[model samples]
Target: MSGSGACEGLPGAVRVVAGVSGSPGSLTALRRAAREAARRGGELWPVIAWELPGGEFHAARSSVPPPLRERCEQLAREELLDVLDTMFGAAGPGVPLHALIARGRPGQALVQIADRDTDVLVLGAGHRGRLHRLLSPSVSHYCLTHATCPVLAVPPSPLEAHLATVCRRNSWHLRLDAGQLTEREKPRGRVRDA
Candidate 1:
């Protein structure tokens, strides 16, 4: 369903492309993209890409086991739907959310889709650890450099949220996206900066 439009009634114009891989970071990005689409009355295109091994692409379809490919496709669909369900419950957003599945490298897939049809490309700020950052380049980094549209990178939770994770261990309820930072849970007399 790369180009398939799951939701209708949206104008055929601008689109918000989000790189979703079902990771916690990607899910956070998806929520931000959905809210942006809802606010701007644009289409939310959540894209997930899968790829065959390097040696398998040139092989004929008959050469690959049918069941394996079928299972891969099924899992891809299920994961995409599950992410959607998890993000927004029974009643989805007012804006149209069209989930898309592309076939290629993740970063390349997102760049291709955005170049073709996207107003903004949004992704989560991936692993910031020294080893990971030094060893591997993230999809967000690739998109920031290559994507035609503007890229919005949402960083992971701040220190307060991290402390909450360690101290209270409560489930995440609020997300900080591209919006004002309201004093929702801050203790009295604690001054917070944006």
Candidate 2:
């Protein structure tokens, strides 16, 4: 409501929520969401969920090794933080960024974030390998299937990445100091070819 929304399908201005899991692909998703929020003059929330690995909860108490287990959990949290730092650093200064940490299933936490806020949510699909296609498994797919708002799946393509960056730079609420959208879009193919 501050200004016209730049990204399509947002009701007006949004409070964009992007889930960061510390995976390489998550940074891609974060960058994309930041751009959208900047372009729309909306708020940006970068959330990291503490998800326990599958079966860890179901294991019997006697079977668990507390020392090694604690180390693994500590490593996970650090990884999440590292990804946040890198993504935010790459986004540079002047782009509004907020960090949120919660404990829950990653998919469930993201879905909850989407449900609570009216902003469009963004998700990243890391290199899931054969398991991804076979399982049809991805955070983006899960959110799109369940979240309340329209979700944007940022593809890994470099051109799409540039569009996201430039889009943020052109955000309605923010000063348009970055390259124009046309200047960044469709870098590889001809306009007609794409």
TM-score per model over all chains: 0.71, 0.59
**What is the TM-score of candidate 2?**
0.59
Which residue runs of candidate 1 sit more than 4 Å off their true CA positions? 1-12, 53-63, 116-118, 159-194
List model 2 lDDT by residue over 9-83, tens digit each: 345546788887765567788888888888878767777766344443654444656776566556656776677
At residue 120, candidate 1 shows an lDDT of: 79
Q: lDDT of each prediction vs. the true structure?
A: 0.73, 0.65
Clash-forming residue pairs, model 1:
none
Clashes of each: 0, 1
Per-residue error for 134 in candidate 2, Å, reads: 4.1
lDDT over C-alpha atoms for residue 171 of model 1:
53
Worst 10 residues of 1 by lDDT: 1-10
lDDT for 98 in candidate 1 is 71
Report residue 127 deviation for candidate 1 (angstroms): 3.0
lDDT of 2 at 41: 83
